[model samples]
Target: MDKDDQPERTVTKPQARVVDPPPDSEATLIRPPPAPKPPASPAPRKDSGNQLPVGTFLGEFEITELIGEGGFGIVYLARDHSLQRRVALKEYMPSALAARTGPLEVSVKAERYAETFDAGLKSFVNEARLLASFDHPSLVKVYRFWEANGTAYMVMPYYEGVTLKQKLKEMGAPPNEAWLLDLLGPLTEALLVIHADQCYHRDIAPDNVMLLKGTGRPLLLDFGAARRVIGDMTQALTVILKPGYAPVEQYAEVPGMKQGPWTDVYALAAVVYYAIVGKTPPPSVGRLMNDNYEPLSQLAQGRYSPKFTAAIDRALIVKPEERTQSIEELRHDLGLDTMAPAPRPAPAPAPARPAPAATAAAAAPSAPAKKGAMVAVAGLVALVLAGGVGYALLGRDAPAPAPGAAAPAPPAPEPASAAVATAPPPAPVAEPAPPPPPPAAIEARFDPLQDFERVAAGQSADFGVEAATAKPQFRIDRDYLSFTVKSTREGHLYVFLHGSDGVLVQVFPNAASRNNKLRAGQTITLPPPQSSWAMKASGPAGTDHFIAIVSAYPRDFGAIGLKVQDGFGMASAEAVAEAARAQGGAAPLFLGKPVCSGDCVDRYGAALFSSQQIP
Candidate 1:
């Protein structure tokens, strides 16, 4: 297909008046209006419609070759003369509205498109400016942008990598959950960041995700903001949205049906669906009608976890309101606590009227609303009641009778084993007891290590730990704790101490010894004699859990946005989770801890040891 005749879209007009390009240090050299081509000149390639020739100069950039073309613009590999580096230069040339009339000049294809083309150009530059403000590894960074030759261009890093689409095609099979989750870690973090600034990708297909060479770190490309602007103006929905990947909201805007983070969530889920099922889900709009979309839970059964599949299903919900509303919600549902510790959990959806069996089941301890320690407490209460224990032994005052209501008589005590068998069937008039309050309503220690352990369960490496203290049970401010960690595979090692004092700190990979690389079968000791730091037992007088992990890949705590305390990176499970959630998009700090795609095995190991802290 010829690039010139390809489908294209236009940008939406900004509410504010369009402004001229800001002054740039590098002056543009304009060429005169185009003249008739010489009869002897060779014809241009069909796909090379109005693109600049190789070696064509635009400001400080020298075009080397055309890299890609879309409805809204053209991308070129260029030499940044000023920086002495290679760059991916993008030109705001909407093919449907504008053309390169002169060697370096872009003009509207027809007089009627003049205003539409100009509006799109402004939006393109603005979008570039917005992208430049973001500093995330997953997002493509725009170094500079300017207007020249009646058009605008933005310079970005010439990243070396293939698209997720291309990579998947070569692999010839769906990626595994860990690999998908690993990919999602950074991508979601990036999306959350942009979405925080009220920017939406709107276009998050596999092709838009570039996996960097060697590292496989993802770089988001071709955001829809500028493309959307032109797309809306041209009323070219088909050209703007990639089918199957796009949600129903993108097909047509309706009351209460609009684009937001969930829109991107749906697209991302669709991408995952493509990776796992070997095809995108049925188009979201079609699902809204006949609703033939099969849940990932059914198709990907045994291949992926229920939590992972359910989250994707929720995000792909046809109605925006019913769908996973934000990436934070999706992350939590997917069990990637990589986001900040305490984002206000998404409100539970209004429950449907349940049948008698479901109502009884809902009141059972296994209910989803009861989490962590709360469930354990509920189980204990049920056991005590079944044992026919005195009310006072239950350790809580019972509520007084309702105002103006008669006090009910106490029921006859029943034996522990016969409690369920002897109880009368629930009456039709009786209401199901309300579920216990969620954990957040009460004082609960937020253990971040639990989240860390959950992620680490997916890793497969042989790790062993041995901890020795200067004293029997480390006395606060008196004794120091030293631990030895050994792994069967050579990899980066990370050690964290979750002190009973309610603080978490990275012990290894600290300022004293930043290099955490450990050789296979090598036994490494923390707080080596050569280091400037020591792991002195701290107080609060409780157990201190020391976690040691040797990962195939080095972890980057920058995504956690933790600050150095003394010489080591200090963080709380609460603080890190909150930061991860806020980061919205960040590369995984420990890729080895998560599940990998295909037959890919992330070789990593972890061991945890506990010691008492005394005053």
Candidate 2:
């Protein structure tokens, strides 16, 4: 790539300047001119080794025109046909080491670049996955993404907005405290949400920040989690960073150089400083060496609140520890004290009931209470018996038996009280219903490699072969394992963990885990209610495997008919492939094959299937 054709970048590492005290008078305020916007993208590049052709289909998205290009990738304005709407599509085309072989495959230029290329590919996919979890108004939404041809692509909503830097350029001056506070307030809260998820938006700058044209809401765009090896990147040291906005920690590659919320704080503070003064803040590296950059407190006296200005200055501190550590502290300094914190997890479940305690409590009341009631009832019963004997003898008019003499027989003459009543017997007591049973642990689903190998025998070389079968690395034993399987393109993920002892467990779409459908470029993880496979039970010491089969459409696992017993399901993957092939369920890719003109990716169901051992 020619230097003139490449995207315009700012990567100056100017010599350190002498330190000076901040200005106390307005006359000393030396506000710099606004930084220039990034140069317009050149005409769409041709589809060759490392680029996609215009009109090529990436699952649901159709590439329309190249919109932007950077050192690592290209962005395109595309149409999402399924929804019939426009979207911004980003493609990972790291031309430094790899290129596209077809509209669906990538080839590395050299063997040495393989690991670095794979690392960047994984990072791009991971960036999409992480951003998918966020839904803030001040954050761009990543709808979905997928891999095809040789690189990965991310689908995001195409919004109308100018970057903060561009907005400042048009304004010709710093925005007032009213506009800044309203914008940065919600923006700070959004960063809090991102931080809570344990993520750092390492690239937060005026250029990366956008003010939405529709609502005037500020969105922090293009988070830099896809920071990868710089040696492999074409732009030397500054490839992953915006020089003036990036913190000191980002410049060094030291092992203990930790980055966290504090790194984001520095970048965001620099953005605030830029909005106040027209120019970019001095780079953190330059500041650390010479310590000569002016502070915000000195720059804003009567123009902004003292507390707000001070917080910004503190956050701009060169050392991470001296800066405001959290968004809450920053907000507090700005006097938004009553704002609520982010939503937290629900309270934990109640502790289990102790049987002995219940039994003891029941026993404590039972004996004493029963004794008192019994005493009262027994006395009344004795009184009734004594009175009955006396009444019968006195009213009978018959003689009682004398001492030592034979007793006279009692008369059976009491046939008088026909109206005498008896109480109905107590209604039979009902027993309480038993509690419902606990949820059944998911049954295992397994597709053996032998079966898959047998099935792939009929498939073309692109479908892979025996040498690629069940490449189990024996790393995990006598411990639980978490698994994730990500497809290069959008498709349904049917995952099965085949234990060493023949137990086949379905990780997705099980009774316990039901997310069988995957979005384009979806990365489904393990232990599914939301994620992928997890093996809890340890079995015999042998090779266990992960069998993943993704198709362009969802398949009915019921139709394939696998033997299911003890909550586990097992079928040969070969049977599945044979079934699919016999049914013409998968598309055939040819080296010199005649290609369809229409959207073939969606029209014909193509599958890229593979299996590997669980780590």
Candidate 3:
């Protein structure tokens, strides 16, 4: 397609307004008339009656019907002549308003227009570059990209199955547990690869995940909103978040809150919740910021396991800090935590010392024995020296040889006597033992989600009741918890958590809500704190469900303190007893009263309470 031959775009004008000049005399300053309207650039010539459609052919692609349109451009189904395959081609739309607006509007629009174009082009190029770097079965493949007539388009493997959203609508809200389990692993794996590449798919929803016609795996699509993990800065374009599925941060205008793995985690959990439950999970940080929602386990009627609900909970925490911090953490919440940790390099061994070589001189034979006459003379001299030293040292000890002089050598031993003495005492012999091998260190591995399941099952066994159906499961860890539950009866599931006090802590609604249904196979992570609510069918009218109750004792010490005042004629103990009775002593108390003395009594009513003591 030639640039000049493309059709001219239509531009809509803003509503016109009449403004009155200020009454001040200076307002009278005249302004020059606007320049005569330039002849309308003849609308770019349209195709002749017999010409092919606008998106027909470019290079070897045979463009088919338009499949979708968006703010920046349109997408078309096309055939790749070279490969004989179908593909999706996204083309950018040129701005026509830029030429008609006033100077300021023109400038702003021009900048935005340029930005949109650049961002789209950059995203197309980056997505291709990133996706081309890996070949995960769950990720859509980008084959090629190019520009024609000043519009850029990327060719991606066309998917035939309905989007998760469409499937959800068809199935109704809250699809079955079997559906959730099947899709969780593949989606998680896809996310792991994406994050590993340092890219974030800002837009993650059921609509972007397509269930391929004949494959079990779901293909993640639309990298147009994906952004590189560089700094805190968000992509130049407005962050595009699907309202119910997007985390609160995505809705913030400030760039600092825009991009992070938590955003994707939230979206992922939403999809899961929608699959298991039939409705979107309640907002954890938005309107339901206050802790006042039912637990996911109770809500789902124990249809899914608690561990599953906990996984989704952690993924959707309102505070990113409270949510799953990394992809590995999210994976762990799902049953897929068994993945081997990255291999660590072994440590280098220490160098060994070389042994010294034996010397030739030391190993040589001893010299021959000296003459017998010399030995006899030396013995006589030694005898004379010993006798003289003994006589001189009679008063104390024998005198020693002169300090600097050498001592005389002894005579050679007799052969027979010497041999007998030498052989008489043999030194004791000792045996040596072999060295022991090095001790080994044991490595630790654990999956809390799995552990919870075992524990929950064991507890249920004690009661002689097997889990009839897997309810949403949840597992709480130090920083986060995750769980899953049904959001709607039509299979629009959501996994969300409430604080122990019943406050909604987080929610992850399924991305697909069009028909409020979900496909049979879908999975999602529940938000954290091991707290969540799962929606369940009441079974037409009446069905018994499990409910966890925690009761605390009320403390009356403060009331007793207040009764100790001098004004109370009765004893402090009696007054406290009466007050306790007045306050419904046996009932569960959520608050308590403080000590009331002279001043306190005057300021507050006698029966006024201080802090509500938890019972």
TM-scores for all candidates: the values are: 0.49, 0.50, 0.42
Q: What tens-digit string does per-residue lDDT give for candidate 2 at 334-389?
A: 76556343322222121111111000000000000000111122221111110000
Per residue, candidate 1 scores C-alpha lDDT tens digits across 39-65 of 212334456687776766553356778
RMSD to the true structure for each prediction, in A, is 28.3, 31.7, 41.6
Models ranked on lDDT: 1, 2, 3
Best candidate (score: lDDT): 1
TM-score, candidate number 2: 0.50
Task: Give the runs in model 3 whose Cα sits over 4 Å from its true position.
Answer: 1-55, 94-112, 226-239, 253-258, 283-295, 339-615
Model 2 clash tally, residue pairs: 22
lDDT for residue 490 in candidate 1, whole number 0-100: 76
Per-candidate Cα lDDT values, in order, are 0.56, 0.47, 0.36
Tens digits of per-residue lDDT for model 3 on 433-465? 333211100001111111111122111100111
Question: What C-alpha root-mean-square deviation, in Å, does candidate 1 show against the real structure?
Answer: 28.3
The order of the candidates by TM-score, greatest first, is 2, 1, 3
